[model samples]
Structures are given as C-alpha cells and as structure tokens.
Target chain A: MPTAPAGTLYRGREGMWSWVAHRVTGVSIFFFLLVHVLDTSLVRVSPEAYNAVIGTYQTPIMGLGEAGLVAAIVFHAFNGLRIALVDFWSEGARYQRVMLWVVLGLLVVTMAGFLPRHLMNVFGAE
Target chain B: MTAVLENSTDTSGSESQAGAVSSFQVTLKIRRYNPEVASEPYWEEHTVTAHGTDRVLDALHKIKWELDGSLTFRRSCAHGVCGSDAMRINGRNRLACKTLLKDINPDKPITVEAIKGLPVLKDLVVDMEPFFASYREIMPFLITSGNEPSRENIQSQADRDRFDDTTKCILCAACTSSCPVFWTDGQYFGPAAIVNAHRFIFDSRDQGGTQRLEVLNDKEGVWRCRTTFNCTEACPRGIEVTKAIQEVKRAMITRAF
Candidate 1:
C-alpha cells in the first residue's frame, strides 16, 4: 500500500458524483429498511411492543428523519432507473449526463408533490 | 507560494508583429518524491515565464533543463502520440503535452502530480506494471483459430470502422488510473482492459470474442463498472471508454442466459 496520495484530488464529473450519491442513498435505505422490518415485526411479540416502538417514530425529530429517508429513497429509485437506461438504452451512454439531469428533474417534481402533503400530515395534525 | 525562480528569456526589445502575445510568469507546484531520498513526498514550486502558446510540457522542460538537475518525468514523442506524460493537472487527469498553460489559467499556481490509482516510483513517474498486467489479461492481440491465411486478411472498411475508436489507445494508463473503482481496489478489470477487449471482440476479422468475454466475465470484470465516466473523461485520445465498457457489459449479457 502506498503511504501517500501525493496526487491532487480527482474531480470526477456528474456521472461519478451521481454514482456516489446512489451508493450512499442505497446503503442508508437498506439500514432504514432493516430497522423498519424489525420494529414492525414487534407486532408478532405483542401489540404493546409494537405500539411502544411505533409511538417513538411519531415525534417531530422522527418526522424530519422520515423526510430525509424519503428523499434518499426517491433519489436512489430515480438514479437506479437512470443506471438502467445507461445499461440498456442504445443512446444512453452518449446522453448519460443529460439523463442525470432528467433524473434530478423527476426527483424535484416527485419530492415537491410528496413533501408538502407529508409534512402537513406530520406537523399540521394533532 | 514561492518567489520567482527564473525567467525563460527577455523579450522587451524583440520585434512585435500583428496579434503578438507576451510572456508571463507561470508558477508550477510539482509533487516530488524519491524513495531513496525521503519517505514522504513534498510539493516543490517553481515559477517560469511562458507564452500563451506554450504547453505544460514546455514549462516542465524549462524547469528540468535550467533549474533542477533531478526533475524527472517520462516522455517520448512529446506531441501527444506516445502518451507517456499523463498526470494530474489542477485536479484533472490530462496529458501535460496537450494541456496549454494559458488555457488552465496561469494566474494560480498549476499543480502537477502523478496520476492516481498506481504506485508512484518517483516524481511524476509510476510503475505501470499493474496497468499493463490488466491489459495483457484480456489478450489484446487478435486471435484467429483457423488455418493461416493464404492471402492478406480480408476486411471491409465498414468492418474496420466498428472497432476503430479503441485502436487509438496508446496504453497510457490515463483512463485506468482515473477510475475511482480502480483507486479503491486494484483488482477491477477497469475501462482500459474492457476497451481493448471491445476492440478485438467486435472486430469482424478476429475470432476471440468468446475467450475475451469469458476473461472479462469474472467477479472483478466488466460487471464491476458502475458507469462512472471518469475513464471517458480521462482518455487523452478521446475514446468513448464508458460506452465501450457498457457495450462489453451488453455483450456479456447477450452471451449468458
């Protein structure tokens, strides 16, 4: 192993950055899904255990965490589709940077539609 | 920042023609390392006057010839054909011979360092064995299994055009070293290998598609490409590297069930 990375940092283009985001979001979503499955499975033990776990997830802080998780999932999903296009579509390679922009556009639209309503449901409700 | 070291030449009294440009001081910060001299690499700075038409390679030549006796870098053709002088210039993989000093903004000190994802032997030179090993793994030469041709190998221009883009590879290791995947784990087959494989695999005159595809279908093969375009962007020869890797992946899928 080389001790020093004396070279300057590589400035990768949008493709590299998007892949990085996709990997990070994917891992985050995986861990969140693991917790979700475990907490939801508490229902098998007892309704009280299930309610106790679910109640902690209803607070304001948990609401914000949920929002971030949603954002991650949305980005991962849309970026995965873009990756699929880069794989299967004939012109995908030539237009990959453009497709990344398209994925970001779709994410903004989807998030705009979902965030406001979901936030109201979390904060506006009693 | 270091003080001005030396200037190339005084041009104040020279003849001035139409649209003539003047020389300006360009500072270069190069990463220097030698295993025998020091255990750690250090940034050595030098400033030299250069015209807008000069290249980064020309500045380096000035430094090596006049300033330092030990400044080391590899080059042969110096005209971008030999592909020996690829380095990280201002955080980008580029050929020093091809990058003009003026285009990269000489106001700020331009940094030159060895390309990443390979073992640096000394200043601006890395051991290219690992790079060529992966190239050799794919069996880059044409493989024809049938009897020897009585006449010259027959091929149409259209057949030649199919793999013409990859033939421009000078095996510079620029694309392979720019790869983020190759940086993390050196086992990945990398874009260069796949691009070379795409060359012979798609050639109508070659009969090595199956063998090359099998070599690239390993766990660390073409499947590991995450579609990052670093290789394509880093190619000095303008090869569509990511597209070549994608084509190889598609071919692999078409091969298997």
Candidate 2:
C-alpha cells in the first residue's frame, strides 16, 4: 500500500458545512430522542412518578439544555428539508447557497421567538 | 501584396491593433512535492507573462519551458477531453486545460494543487489507481445477456436519451475528489463511481442493473453519499452527478419494495 498523508483538513463551502452540521445535529437528536423516549415511557408506572420526573426538567440548566435541543432540532429539520429539495428539485443545486442562508435565517427567527418564553418559564417564581 | 501590406501598416501605424495581443504577469503558486527529495509538500511560486485568453495549462507550460525545467504536471490533449489535468485551482477542483487564467481572478496569486483525497505522486500528479479501482468495481461497461446482436442494438431516441448525461463522463476524478465523504472516508465508492453505475443502471439495454444495485447496496457504497452538491459543482463535464446518485438510491428503494 502506498502510504500518504492522512487527515488533510478539507476546506469546503456552504454545502459541505451544511452536511457536517446535518450529521452532527442528527446524532445529537438521536441520543436525545433515546433519553426522551425512556423518560416518557415512565408514565406507564404511575402518574406521580411521571410528574416527579417531568418536574426535574423545569430546572434552569435543563431549560438551557432544552433550548440547545430545540436549536438542534430546528437546524436538522430545516437542513434536512433543504437537502430533500436539492435532491428532488432540478434547479436546486444551483440555488443551494441561497437555500442555506434561508435555512439559517429561519432558524435564528424561530430560536429568537422560543428562547425568551422558555427561559421565562424556567426562571420565573410560581 | 507587399504594397497592400505596406499601405495597411502605414494607414494604421499609430492605432494598429490587428494582431497585437496584450500580455500581463500572473503568479502561479503551485504545490510541489517530491518523495525522493523532500518528505513534505511545499509551495513554489512562478511569475509568467500570459495573455488573457491563455488557460491555466498554458501558464504551467510557460513556467516549465522558460523558468524551470523540472516543474512537472500531466497533460495530453491540452483540451478538457483527456481528463488528465484535473487539479485544485483556487481551492476548487477544475480542469487546468479548461479554466482560463482570467476567469479565476488572476489579479491575485492563483493557487494550483493536486486533487484532494488522492495520494500525490509528484507535482500536480496524483495516483489514480485507487480512483480507477472504484470505477472498475461498479462494472462500468454494458453487460448484456444472450448472443451478440447480428448487426446493431436498436433503441429508441428516448431510451438512448435516458442515460445520455452520464455518458459525457471522461472518468475525471474531479467529482469524486471534491466529495467530503470521500475525503473523510476512503472506503466510500464516491460520486463518480456511483454516477458510472447510474449510467448502466438506467440504460434500457443493459441487463446488469440488478447486479450493480447489489454491489452499491453495501455500507460504503451509494449509501455513504451525503448529497452535499460538491460533486455536482466540481464536475468538469457538467453532468448532474448528485441527481444520478439519487436516482440510483431511488432505484435501490424501488427494488426493496
């Protein structure tokens, strides 16, 4: 085998960066889904047990973590839609850079709307 | 004719611009590597006077012929048909013979390097054995059953047009090397190999579609493609490479159903 340099850092454009972000967000969502499923399944045991477990999620740290999860979900969903459009639409490849900016813009707008309300719930005294 | 030439030259003596082509200095920052001499690759810059219409290959040729005798690169047709001069120009994969000096911002220093994800053999030459190996694995040729046709294999215009775009491929590694998946993972079949598979898979006369689909069903085969559009952007032949790969994936899914 001819030995050559390995792991040369490739500088890719918006499409490549979108691919990397998609994969990263996908893996994070998968792990988060696993824990979510396990926690949601606890409702089968008793109502109080499920309520107690759900109450723990109201903490400020969990609020911030949930915000991160929401960001991941938003990015994954929007980017996945962009990938699908690029795959199916004939002219999608030509307008991909434009689509990436649109996805980013939508993500920022949606996160801005959700974060403040979610944080208020976490830090507010009830 | 001599009198006519003298008259024309005298008539336009101050403003004659018939065959006068302007040339400007352009710097080519080429990546150089020699395993026998140095363990690592290094940058070498050469400034050459070239016309605006000159291709990047012409600049390299000028540098080799005038400045340095040892500056090496590969070329055959000096046109884009041979697919021998595919390299990274200004951080993008393009054919040196097709990319003109002025098209890629010649005002700044132009960067010339070998295609990514391939082992560099020398300056601007990469080992193509691995790339060809993947091409061969996809069974690129037409595989028909039964006896050979007596005269010619007849097909309708629509049938021939089905796989026409992929036939334009010159086996250039530009699309494959530009793929981020192929850069990170060497085992992936890459877009070019899958595009070749798509050519035969969608062929109306080919009977090897099932076998090719089975070959690409592996983990490192067509499934590894992330549809990043890099391959489509890098293809010198302008083939819709990502769409062809997607067609193969769709074919596989249809087969499963």
Candidate 3:
C-alpha cells in the first residue's frame, strides 16, 4: 500500500543490462520452444496434417519472426557462456565488460551468416 | 555564543571564504514525502549558492538550515565512514557525504532521493530493518571451534589477503539497494550480506564456512543473484561485492560435489 514513485531508473552499466537482456531473451526462447513442440508433435496424426502445419510457418512474416527468434537465441547462448566464465574464472568479473563486447561481436557474426540465406529461402519466388 | 553560531554556517560564510573562489548557486530537486502533510510524494527543488569543495551533504544541510526547515535526512561523520548518508543521486546509489556537488554536474539540478528497494520513512531516511535483517542472517563474525587459543588466534598474511577486499564494508546499504533484483523482490539476501559472509567465510581463523555456505545455498540466497554488477558499482567502499557474492556461490557449488 506504501507504493510511491521512487526515483530515476538505476543507471547500471554493462553487467546489469546484460542480465536483463538475458532474462528477456530466455523467456522469449522458452515460449518459442513451447510452440515448436506443439507443432512438431502433429507428426503422429497424419502426413498431410504435419505438412499443413509446417506450410503455415513458410510465410514472410513467420520468416521475420524466425529471424527474431534466432537473434534472441544467439544472444542468449553467447551471454550464457559469459555468465559461466564470470562464475568459474577468477578474473572473469574484472573482464566481464570486455566479454560482453565479445558476446555481441559473436552475435553479429552468427546473425549475418544465417539471415541472408534464410531470407532467400523464405521470400524467393520458388 | 551568537558569534560562534554566526561563523558556523556561511550563507555567506565558510564557503565563500574557503578560498579566493566565490560560491556558485546549484539546484537540488529532492523527493519529499511526509504522511502527516501529503499522502503522496512530491519533487521539491531549492537552489543555493555552494562552494567548489561543498559535497551533497553540505548542500542538504544548507537547504535544511537556510531554505527549508522542514527538509529531513540522516547523516553522521560527514566524511563517509558512517554509511548513514547513502542515497540515490542522479540515478545512482552513492554516499552524499562523498559525492561532491561539482563532480555530479551541478549545472543541471541534481536529483536526490532515498536509496531504492526499501520503504521510505521520511524525506531521505528509509526503513533499514530489512537490509539489516539480511546482514544479521549472515552471522558476520569470526566463528571458531573449541580449544581456544591462550592469547589470540593468529592468521597468516596470505590468509588475511583472501578476504582483504571484502573487509572494507561499512554496511552502507548502497550496494544492496541499487540491486535490480532486490528492488523487484525484497526476499533476496542481497550482495551486502553475501559480501560480509565472504569476509568471515574466507577468514583462515573462522570455522563456520560450512554453516555459512548452507545459509547462502537457500532458494532466495546466492542462487538468486544474476551476476548483475550493480552491487559492485554502487559500493562506496570499493568492495568487490559481485565478486564476493560469486565467491560465496562458488563455495556452495564446491561444497556440493
């Protein structure tokens, strides 16, 4: 009941923001996984049923959604490794900011390699 | 007595004459809440002339004495050792006594408020009970076994160095309150408690490592920390708070297997 507007947002540096991003990307990935499981489980019913479900996902909008999902997955995977290093390595905390740059660099590289090819497969008039 | 009092505070006093440089005016926008007066909190601004050497604490003192007698805050040992003056200044947790008005860009009105993650008791004071409760739960002491030493329990220099970084804690709630998780949910034990636990856990002379690790291994304990370094950045004492909490977490993981 004593809730009151506190103050300005806490201006945390890289480490804090990374944790927030990790949480968000993690939850989004979980939801994506749930959808994937439900759709893939349709294979048991009939071949046409599973093919129809897969066909619905071949559109350009779903292609964009898949791209976003890949971006989230890429960031979460790389940042997860960074968190592990921050825990296991003695100098990890000192170098966490540097590692964040590395993780971001890796995300950019991974996304660049996957985006154009995936976009062509979805949007090309085949 | 009146003359001594007159020389004590310089609306035109200690500041203007501290050196050849005259005082300059700076504005402070403070968050104020008094249940008796207003049911809601409001932003109050007061601009006062301050010297280059003046800290945020001194500015607050000037506001309370000269501008508004109703302004209230807590402070002692104005140099920063006491830790009672921790507050959020310009969107960060810092000791008001240590943060200089000049350092925080006084050209823009500095926003001052109670440190977050705790119930605000008044203008800048907060309910420190929860913060202290977590600290107390850690058992911050040199716990040892029987067959006590006749004179003292001696520890090697190498052993002392193990926890040297954590030993600088002044119990300022700056680190704990700045934590995002603690702000979301007050149930987390917080970084200050884990840092203090690291102080005693790594002490070569202490025999309570196992018990302390068990405490930190709780559901709402070290496991809840998400490696956010806000606690490390907010510590006024330069304590490696996040590192210490990770060390406590590592100690728990090591004890398990």
The best candidate in terms of TM-score: 1
When 1 and 2 are scored with lDDT, the better candidate is 1
| Model 1 segments more than 4 A misplaced | A1-6, B1-15
Q: Comparing 1 and 3 by TM-score, which wins?
A: 1
DockQ of each: 0.68, 0.32, 0.57
lDDT tens digits by residue: candidate 2, A30-86: 999998998899999888888999988878899889999999999999998998887
Residue pairs whose backbone atoms clash in candidate 2: none
B148-217, model 2: which lDDT tens digit per residue?
A: 7898888899998989989999887999999988876878998989989989998998999999999999
- What is the C-alpha lDDT profile of model 3 across B13-102, one tens digit per residue? 555554344357799999998978977789999998787778999899999998899998989898889999999999899999999899
- Candidate 2 at residue B82, lDDT? 87
Q: What overall lDDT goes with each candidate model?
A: 0.89, 0.86, 0.89
TM-score of each candidate structure, all chains considered together: 0.93, 0.83, 0.91
Q: Which consecutive 10 residues in model 2 chain B have the weakest lDDT in total?
A: B1-10
Q: By descending TM-score, how would the candidates be arranged?
A: 1, 3, 2
Worst 10 residues of 3 chain B by lDDT: B1-10
